[model samples]
Target: MKGPLFYAKILLFGEYGIIKDSKGLAIPYNTYQGALKKSKNLSEVSKKSNENLKKYFDYLVGLETTLVTFRLVEFKKDIEEGMYFDSSIPQGYGVGSSGALVASIYDKYADDKITVLENLTRDKLLKLKQIFSKMESFFHGKSSGLDPLNSYLSLPILINSKDNLEATGIPSQKEGKGAVFLLDSEIIGETEPMVTIFMNKMKNEGFRKMIDEDFAKYTDACIDDFLHGNMKSLFGNVKHLSKVVLDNFKPMIPTAFHKVWQKGIDSNDYYLKLCGSGGGGYILGFTENFEKTKKILKDYKLELVYRF
Candidate 1:
């Protein structure tokens, strides 16, 4: 049986900055999504997914927590019968592929599961984040859990900080000259290693200060501007944020795009920033004029996410 579809998510603002308590905004990307289903004759890809689920089942069973529990009996039965997550959300692209899978499994098997219909209070939302943090950690090695949280709720989430995030209503997309788009890098990114690099960079006092001052400031401003529909301020702040990421988070930016990233900032046609963890996935882009930007970057595959 097929279950409900869980959508991919875009961390519009606050990529690495969120780890340091910077304000962040995430929105559901409906272009790609995932759901659970079973097949008697497992295809090669389905077979791989089923085998992965088996391992995930073991992890959940062994997890010691009162926060949430799953119906292991039924889950195991499904796993044995060739259940797999059929999804189009590309992994390592930073668009929450695993997050959708985690959400789907939790939706179907978790006892006392939090439903999207309920009044999701601040405490309840945090609880969901905490529970998701635990469950999704199996995939990311370490997870802030925002990915799964966004996928599960199918709502835009605004992060005031690590402890203070909530389902937020973003201004409806206006058909205008401005837009946000995704530029596919066509390379797989490993979250664990990228994270390790960031953690190691944190040990440097200089990096820490820059993150606290420059990164956090621009990130918060961008989030505020985005929510308020302040296109002018949003573009300015995003330009700063994009520059900061380019200058400092160089390692995270895939090597091939260094020239391309800088070219945008130079030309003012578009500004590019990390879509997720960088190092290869989707690079987030912003342009004041989509028509011009479209012609400017015709060599690339540009996917429209939101119109401003």
Candidate 2:
């Protein structure tokens, strides 16, 4: 038997800035998705997935909460019967690989689960985010829960702050030269370590000031600009945000891409920023000329998200 599918997600704007109440935007990435399935004979890859499911099942069983409950007995039976998460979303690529799995499991086993078909109110959305944060924290030591929330609803989510968020609409994609894309770093990013670095930086008054004045400012403006279908303004703000990241969040950036990241801003071809927690994953990119940027970034792989 196969469970329902859950798509991957792209945090186009938020990244680390969301942790400190900066505005952020995320959209569902339909190119990659996941679902639960069972087989009588498990392949090596399936076996590994099954093993992880067993561990996650144990964690769920121990959770004490009123938010939601799982069908543990059925879940365990399925696990014993070679149930595993069959997925196409790449892990450690900052595209919500585990978040998709979390959404799928919640869809299948959680009692009183919130379906996407319902008229999702703000309170319901926040509740789901809170539950997802608790559920997804098993994978990352700390989770904002927005990843799974985006995957679960399969809608563009806008984060106004820690306590405010909503499902929002993005302007329809156009076949224009400008685009938002993903640049593969070809290196895995570990969330816990990167978050540790960010947390450490937050302690310094100077760093905190930059985040408040520069990072969050540009990030909020970029989100506002993009949502309003203002590409020109969006690019300008994204450039400023890129510079802020390069100057302050160096540890979160993969060392190899440092020059290129700066070069994107310097040459004005494309601006690259973190996709998730940075360190090494898919770096989010925005360019007014996709063809030119693609040629300049010829050695690396680029996945298009939206065209402007």
Candidate 3:
């Protein structure tokens, strides 16, 4: 048995900001995806996935939440039948690996699950977010549920704030000099530690002030500019947002890439920001000139996301 595919997601804006009820934008990244499958002969990878699912299923059974409930009996039966998640999405890369898994499980076995075909009113979206948050918490110690929500809906979600989000459209991708892309840091990022660092930083009045004044402001602007197809303004705001991240969220970035991160801002060729938690996964980049930025960062692996 095989289930439908669930794509990975990129939180284009509002990485940590969304936790504070700031605006966020998440888009589906079809480059990597996952689905549920059953096989008689399981490979080592699938075997491990199956084991992980067992633990997650057990957790769900004990979890007491009003948001949503899983059909644990059927889910367990599938696991016993050698069910595993066959996925290409890289784990610990901040690209929604576990989120895809959570979405697939909910899609297949959740009792009275909200169908993607529904009208998806604002209340419905919030409920889905709440459900997914509870379900995905088995993976991330804390979750906003936006990743699975994005994958489940397979739509661009515009988050006006924590409780306010809806499926929204982004400017059409165009073939032009400016572009958005992903830079592989070639190192896996652990979400928990990175999140812990952010929490610790929150204790500092200076850090909190910067997040409210600088980080949230620029992030909100970037989201607005991108949605309206205001490329010039988007680039300007992204530059400032990137700098704020470098200065304030330094620990979240991998140490080796500090110089490269700075060089992008210093030269104006590109600006890099955290793709997810950013201890070292894929660093998100925006370049006014794709060709030029690619040439400069030739030593790194770059994947194009959108063009302007």
lDDT of each: 0.93, 0.93, 0.94
Off by over 4 Å in 3: none
Candidate 2 per-residue lDDT over residues 226-256, each given as its tens digit: 9999888899999999999999999989999
Model 2, stretches more than 4 Å misplaced?
none
Worst 10 residues of 1 by lDDT: 15-24
lDDT of 1 by residue, 19-123 (tens): 888889999999999999999999999999999999999999899889998899999999998899999999999999999999998899999999999999988
lDDT of 2 at 217: 92
lDDT of 3 by residue, 88-124 (tens): 9998888899999999999999889898898999999
Note each model's CA RMSD in angstroms: 0.7, 0.7, 0.7
Candidate 2 positional error at 272, Å: 0.6
Q: Model 2's lDDT to the true fold?
A: 0.93
lDDT of 1 at 251: 96
Provide TM-scores for the models. 0.99, 0.99, 0.99
